[model samples]
Target: MEINPAITFQHDRKVMHAKRPKVLIVGAGLGGLTLGAILQKSDIPYEIFERASQVKPLGSCVALNATVAPLMRQLGIYDEFVAMTKVIPSIQIGNENREVEFAMTAYFEEATERFGAESRVISRPALYDLFLKQVPKERLHMSKKVLTTKQGGNGILIRCSDGTEYEGDILVGADGAHSAIRQNLYAELKSQNKLIPSDDAALPFNTISLVGQTRPLTTEEFPFLKKEECQFVRIVGNDKPFAWSTFTTKQQRICYSVVQFLDEESSKLHDSFRNSEWGPEAAGAMCDEVRHFPVISGGDKITTIGDLIDLTPKEYISKVMLEEKVFQTWYGGRTVLMGDACHKLSPAGGAGAGNALQDAVVLANYINALPLHPVVEEIEAAFEAYKTDRIEWCEKAYATSKMLQSVVDKGIKPMLVRFMMKNMPEFMKRRAAEQMYSSRPQVAFLPLDETPASVKPTHQRSLNLRAPVEEEVEAPAKTI
Candidate 1:
């Protein structure tokens, strides 16, 4: 399991010089943007490079759990975060035939009492825009597709597609699941004969997803969509092609994600997702496979995937293969990976983006703790510490999200899942949720700093962890 302790750091020892470390982050997605926000607050100099031509919102919605609220607050965006989100307190699940399977309530209400922060959901664009508000326009470079990196005598040079070059003390890969930076890092390790064959293995896809947002649903059309702002809905089938979750909000349009489990028939389609052009034709073809499946909103109303597809803008409908992957290697020398670059998960618990934001905050903390004008050696050490603090939690979240996704696949196991989940006592449910909800990661050195953002409360009152008498120290990293 030890990965490239085999990949040696090729520092230009003779050319090394001292300078205040500046971070160059690749990808302006949640992880990259959030890291920029934190570094800005700490007065750390950094630049973010995005391949996209503009900062316009591109994706759908994202979920926010108790784990990320403290970091948002510290970045001074908590009120803006709260203002645009809606809290979903319960979940309702059913079969593809519209038969009720199981329903869980008070999970969020209880989670709130347990975590002191609310479990909420918001549009991805709003979050991206909000995070960008703090990032200066000059700091964000657009359409700068990363070409490669070279370690010169003084520092690392990042070459972009337009023949432009940028130099930085450290490079962070936040380029997401298909990360170009991640590929380059591994490519270097591979060139050194240090990367295992599996290091560049393909991500597995057991489910095909079509997610989009629709115009707001009328109460008469779907009561469930409005329940506590948005009823977190999940639907599966015993013998059908698809399963789904209606994600959030009555005030805004209904955001939904319908997943078609891979089967003998659909597996034929899965292979071509990477090559296939996504548009109305693709979405229509996907809907044709599961148009007969029923999505129940309440006791009286039921709709089909075809119905929802008709409501969605063709441009917004995403036909993607849901994947779960945890890379064995996350860093090399002054370059390191963050968020989806290292661990890409199924959007099962709606926790993928939240975990990415957590990675940004934790990584920033480690880097910021270094003495003024830290060396590449110090930056590399901080990267190791960052991975140590995050990898176990990332793996745990990965497994949990996979299980949640499994429940929505078209299989008989969902029947057993319904039985087990429904039979559990609410207190047991609360305790289980408390265990999951309480896992908020923090900067070990933050409490010792004399900054306004440093002393911000964690919004984690339920764990009842005894206040440590002295500064927290690093222990052996947890093994997954």
Candidate 2:
């Protein structure tokens, strides 16, 4: 007779399961959904709350490159994500006259090969739906706005607006820039004189953008849609402080955005975006202003940004203020912030969404390392490590975002930036691309993706972390 190996493995799995902690996530945007998905795979219990009763298509498009593609694969959504996106081979930059200034074709191609993954763009709504599907319907609560949160009963607790309450060992504020949890946490920290001076300041923004995706069109209507490669184009205004971009997608539709770099006086008025609704109505004025902006729709036909605006459903178009800020304080007393809630970034570099997803991954990795009933010190240590591992990357992305923003802005600085980008030395440009593509973090608990790449990825410390397993002590020799 032999002991069963399957039984022994199951016993070990149960031991691992006993160390899992219950997670309470606020917000169901990309970050929150991503964390929930990983926890689902890790067999850790968690719940997600969203203020909206239904998920809305409020954004233009999100580009996923090598940065988070491996994690997407680990989560079992890579193929589906690829199918929904159009690979971006290059980005064509032009001026108000529609004259081509420069193109990043060679750079994009080289980076794609070296990174072992193609950069792909998908409509934001489509992306939201993809990640939302990974989370169980029961675990996601709609229209559940968190009113307040506190630590009690040997754990954390949250009270919803509807008078419902929940308890968990950890609370993750993956909510957007105007996060209620952050507000509450800051208020508490301020009372105790522990809040950082910068963290207490208002969220400053200097650019306002109008983003939308058009209804599907025929090849005859938009010839660019017929092309296998994405027609990615960016245009800088000659006189006005404006820049706009367009991308052809696999859905036979065009995703576009027009940005207005506000002046100092204008920025002061819209400096704090604490209470503002984002939707078509808020974007109506900006739409009218940029209606005449030119776009290359192929076939020598004249197309304006307004034409695409008309093709898009009113509900899908949105006006948003681009805010750039990285809060110094991330976690305090079982409450931690991730994504836009912690590091708000401008969309110029297409890094905001990717960073948010990365935050979810790194954070989930730390949460998975928690013991079944973790003490306060253990929880703080985990949050500190999560922030330590992520802040440097976020700051780098923020700086890159600012640099890209300058290239499209109206000023001598912008002109200089454009010149440098057009004439950047080959080695220098290659080094920059290498730095950008070198960070490809994956889920630590899942099997690693050994698919090789030319550039070595940065080491993720969380991959080396694991919860301590209780050692089996040998029974004392029988005294009887």
Candidate 3:
């Protein structure tokens, strides 16, 4: 009896399917680790490589949007996340007078009712730890930095800085904004004379952020600041640019970050600030500046108390600052990029992590749906779909973040903006809220058949103006 070709193919696929496809995930950050956990639950074979030798509780707090809550729940770690983080109620925006201007909550109840999930805030390290728990230690590789990647007819190969090589069916570059795999892939595409560099855009606000922890203050003591709330207090008519936020954590720790936009000279001076000696003086100066600002009088005694402590200068060193932009392209072949790796938006709107997490979900879903023995054409097609699906949402987020930065960066002009904001009609405020909170298309890992029509990948839509279908095919896959 002769075995039919299709039957043989089916039998071979069954045997091969028993051994899950090997997925190599670069970077152990939120996006990468989340993808690893989701793949593990799906019983897909995978390995995660991080440049850090060991996991450290690094980075600051992240605010989750309604979209991410479901993904976290799906990973079986949502409760663990909640246990490790705080559920902030609303974000309050005000000025030096301590008067509340605007406040927006996460819409938790509505989010749960509509999306079956609620948003929460988690320290980066805590979330990472939770994700690490779900992944096996053996499958997690550390101190492995991807230097380059090569794709051939058979499989994709990743070359590391340590002179080691790993071959896999697919390579997911979750390495962030400056992704090595993504760079290498683009280099190859350019070598083939097919690379198209997207237009570069400048950040609307050039801001610096100083983040640190402070002694807890009661709601009554610091009436201007709310416990478990993100309060944005802007001080108008201040000599120097100043804005501060009070972010409460699950541990009842109040984490605060002060942001200011410096002009050319001040920007350089800030960069050259000395940690050993200058930091103390700078912190003291910053405190003095805050105390003298007109807004300090708006709150009770405890609220003004933050203006007294001369927090060690070294504490100022913990601040994370960035000058960001929305890049033109997010993909370049068998090795595509996601998250901050594509567009590094300002953190004003608290949507950076949310957008990045959504990118990972969408990309992972597209790749998992391909045939086990995928052709280069099929891989390219999937990447094209991912890029097309995400551009607009990313752009909108990029724009919104910049606008928020502009409002905060206001030096002498804040008074004018405030006047307009205060005088704006209720109808106008509602319209703005609708735009701000409107749900964009989310990329999920559901089977194509189960994906809702509204949730369909952005690439499939004819409405994409920024990232058209024809433009997506311009760049061909290449080895770095």
Candidate 4:
């Protein structure tokens, strides 16, 4: 498959509207950017509308597993991706005092062996920069906030905050958890009495975190901080659900996140925070909240959360609540949703980004499978297939994320399970990895037999975008 880095097109409204289907994607996060990359590769025309003027991810770091590697390689940016990230081969779990409670070094190797790519950690901004590099400037309209989407005659119409309306054969919501597109899509469906059971409420979140990248901590200051593939995991206690993760990125810098679960109080503080300005005072308060939390390095070297916070430039850190929500109504008509719009996830399992990219892969495959100048029926069927392929996993992903969060939080039984995971047999650990990654979604366009020769089995499926015309996949009816 040929991956085109960018495709520039002059705006010819008549030709585009009369010919092939055009996709209008909301939100330029990972999912939207990934979809744009796929469509560009397929020579499909599309536009990405982002709320932000520039595509800089809010979080400090993003974890990429083997599951999405093939697609990355297919994009022909694997080398760049590799250069921008570091393999996180070791995950050392510890207490507030930094005393080692349990460690898992073998799982990373096993995952690489079983899944065909090494798990990596990268600066979130760098990741977005890579995607932005591939996407043509003409195709991405920054600061164009999408307000609503409605079904047009045979396509979909989108209204933006800037008093603009755009039309496309299909509209996709990659607009994060609190998606305006998702809300409008569901509202349209509800008006027709066709809305399915959806997870509308924000995930019952009690966790608030501040994550940022800072100047690298030297090996002399923190021994394992510079070690290859080292990922430090710190859990304060079960009494209060709090955890800290510190790891290295590409540049001479480290990224850290401190999360505190507000289970004791009403989510009011969190809910109230949504509208408040996240200015200096708020960031400072969040930093002060966990400044004294101990983060252990090893035998003797120890530091508090404040130490790293003090080193980090004030602008790098982001404070936000971790949410986990899964919606049942993924699609109706030509409007469909992907990524955080449909399924939100906790940061525990590091599954959100991977899952969103997977959504791009699967959804692209289905859309690419369409015949040239497809009718409304074909577009609708593609949307149906995409939803059917993803809804179950969407729900399961939310459950799985919380399940891992429990282990990280270590309430009671989770502590024992965490212990077992720490010293588990190599064979058993690999088995767990095998099970965990067994059903990862694959792009329909990628060949089962990879191009650049994979050393390990890619254990992922490919969608046959170009199928026999005689055989047609029945468009699934909308589900409850």
Candidate 5:
């Protein structure tokens, strides 16, 4: 079947441009790599710098919401995603023994069907692989950690850990929460006396995450476990911290985490996490407590639960901080920031990846427009337009994630939570499901008029023709 030419044009315009703008992308994680893939389709001279020596499968699972589907499709990796991951038709709130409290399958299905998109659960490493494959190997520079970035009249210069310097028309910091570029920007502002003397660092939320894979279990043995569902088994009322288990794969691959809210007293202890390790002894004790409840251990399947898996205790989770005013000044001269660097959203709504991917898409459109016009003002305008269009969506997602986390960490009893779950009206359950599954923001791009002429229709077609002519010219001088 023939693909639409317009779609092809939009996807390949970057490769056809005469002179692409130099784009420096920091970090090679999902957000950074996604941006790289989008830039690959356009005529954008770009490089990706990753701190790690090699890309590793870091996280367990990621929830790909409906909003991310279009971006994935645009990147030409949507089909591969579908094939590699499982579509979570619904989210189920259950207990330790697997007693369903509130089920939301129908609501999720309806929303997806209506929106022409589906939510998928995939291993983070798998998704990263997809993005990495789309980006050219030569363009990805691993083990090059960005130390600092300086913006001058001409362009931006990035200094790396190895003393190498990279000059580019635009620098994008797709780095995560601890962004070096962000810190540099703040330092610049501080030195100019534009900000206060007080420490601007955010207070760390006291929480710990323990992640591990479990042996496969039969559905019959684990009666409450659904085949394709992402189960959020909340254990409330325990003296310990709030805990939950998520099933990301059909083969019983599980991700279980417990979050403890540290009190003032507990926070004072510097080695509190080391002191309270959820090691084999702790896991055994917890298993014993859970085994008593059929719902948690799945009764007969209790034997299959792996021995206390790797424990990541007492790691400080960063709280979401919104720089509502600072976002207005995101584009400083030739350097810009995207993804978490531009807007750091809490992971509660699973919108970070989606939002970051959208940033990449919009930025690519803007950069592709540069070669045609080659105007500094136009480039800056494009960056402003990107921020204008995306700031609200990012802010909202961050706020929503924070709100949901607050509710889950309220210290309600497991029995009471389960009771509430069991008694929740079908309609209410559906509404909540819709809220979680349907909250994805629509993907929007900067107006085409805002796009530089280079990526615009006239210039795109011209560049496409020039390619054929150049090939012909090179082909000529053949022995005739």
Candidate 6:
């Protein structure tokens, strides 16, 4: 299909407005920002409402693979994104004694060659900034916490805490795990007896993590920072229920996180923390506890987790509960949810952020295909098709996250899982990496990426819907 830029003439504002549905996206997180970026590229009208007054650098780092690289290129930010990231050549797993139990080195080269994109790590703020630059400041509304939402005969309306109301054809809940939109949608569904019993249950998790990035350090302090590839090291505790990891970034800084595996007793101890707001204050107590843990930073000079914590600015440190659940209810009426709001994954596997960005691509594609004046039924169908296209991949990512979590978990089963990983064949590891990188979906309404890769990407149904009108009418088989 030959794609043309969406027209927006000063004199034809009415015609431009009638070409696509107006989108109201809640939560200016990774998913929402990405969707807004894609919508902007497609010239679809969108407004983003974020509850936070300002962007806070909470999390440590995100490992983005080939899965979302093409989309980044489509958004015109791939080169800048690559410039800020450090390619992770290999991951070395060690014991509490600082002994290397096993190192995963075989698949990095093969995966890069097969996928045409390297698995790279960038600090959370860098990633946030990369996407933030794509969105226009006027379209972004901070401190606009959505108080409530209602669907009327005309469209959907969201009333913010600031007492301002905005109406749009579609409402997207891109907020985090405890999304307000999901809560409201679920409440409405439950009242109608359409909510799934499993979806109503609380998100379940057994791990808590303290993540932060250290200020730039000299090579004299950490020699590994000079390497071309990232120095990714993960170490398990001796008898303690903790594991610590460090990744050297491109900006001469070390991004680190400590994971705590909780049992029934310890889980209750962290009840208050789990229920607290998502930010840095909650990470204070846990920071002191893990400071004494050792880190393998690749040199004779030993460093403790506390050292890195002390080096990190207080605002950048955060304690996060790694909740792992794939919620069944994704949308209802004109309201829909994406990213962590729908499927919260443990960060151990480094798939959460990547999946969120990919969710934006698939969801935005379907939204772009929506009629200018879509009815409730048409909106629901688009949402259903988006869910159908993404849910399976989300489940696969969730499974992969759980498997990686098991390796760092404190139990006999986790040990066995680690043992299997330690002894797994190189070809099998490469095969697994290929499976993970196979779903590289691009922006459908925009020009498709021609980046070459050895592994065939999974077919995107949304791509077929973006054909020229004449060709589309001739075939007529691309309906969602």
Q: In model 2, what is the error at residue 352, expressed in angstroms?
A: 0.6
lDDT scores in order: 0.71, 0.85, 0.60, 0.73, 0.56, 0.86
Please write out the lDDT profile of model 5 over residues 1-480, one tens digit for every residue: 221212211223334444456789898888889878877765557999988787643444677766566566655567778887777765555544456556535445654445446677765656777788999999999889889777654456788999988877778888766667767766766676654433355424454443434444445645434545555444432344444445545445554544445565655652333333223333443343333322254444452222323222212111112122124346655567787676665444556777788677666665665544244565677677667766666666766666545434544463454456457677786665554443332213311222111111111211111111111223446586
Q: Rank the candidates by TM-score, best first.
A: 2, 6, 4, 1, 3, 5
TM-score each candidate. Answer: 0.84, 0.93, 0.74, 0.86, 0.72, 0.93
Off-target runs (Cα >4 Å) in candidate 1 are 1-18, 55-58, 264-268, 275-282, 299-302, 443-480
CA shift of 27, model 5, Å: 0.3
Model 4 lDDT tens row, 1-480: 121213223343434433556899998998999999888876567999998776544577888877678788878888899888888776777775557776677647746556777788888888888888788889999989887676743567787889988878788999888888888877777777777654544456777778887766677666555566646465646455678887766675668888777765656757877534233346777787778787665436567778878878777777877777777788776778999888888877788888899899889888877765565566778888887777666666677677667666746678776777777787787665665554555556655426332234323333656632323445779999
Tens digits of per-residue lDDT, candidate 1, 29-93, equal 88998888778766567999998887643345787877787676666677878888888766777
lDDT of 6 by residue, 173-242 (tens): 9999999999999998999899999999988878899999989999878888979889888898879899
Compose the digit string of candidate 2's lDDT tens values, residues 1-480: 221212211133333435566899999999999999998987678999998898878888988788998899898899999899988887788877777788865447665568878889998989999999999899999999999887743677788999999888789999899999999999989998999999998888889899999999888777788788788889999888899999988888799999988888877766553368678878887899999999977657788999999999999899898889988999997889999999999999889999999998889889888765676677889999999999999999999999988878888988898888888888887788878777788888898877777888889899876755655655779986
Colliding pairs, model 1: none
Question: Candidate 3 clash total?
Answer: 5
Worst window of 10 by summed lDDT in candidate 5: 453-462
Predicted structure 6: lDDT: 0.86
Clashing pairs in 3: 96-295, 176-341, 177-341, 389-458, 389-459
Off by over 4 Å in 2: 1-19, 268-274, 470-479
Which ranking of candidates, highest lDDT first?
6, 2, 4, 1, 3, 5
Question: Which scores higher on TM-score, 2 or 5?
Answer: 2
By lDDT, the better pick of 2 and 5 is 2
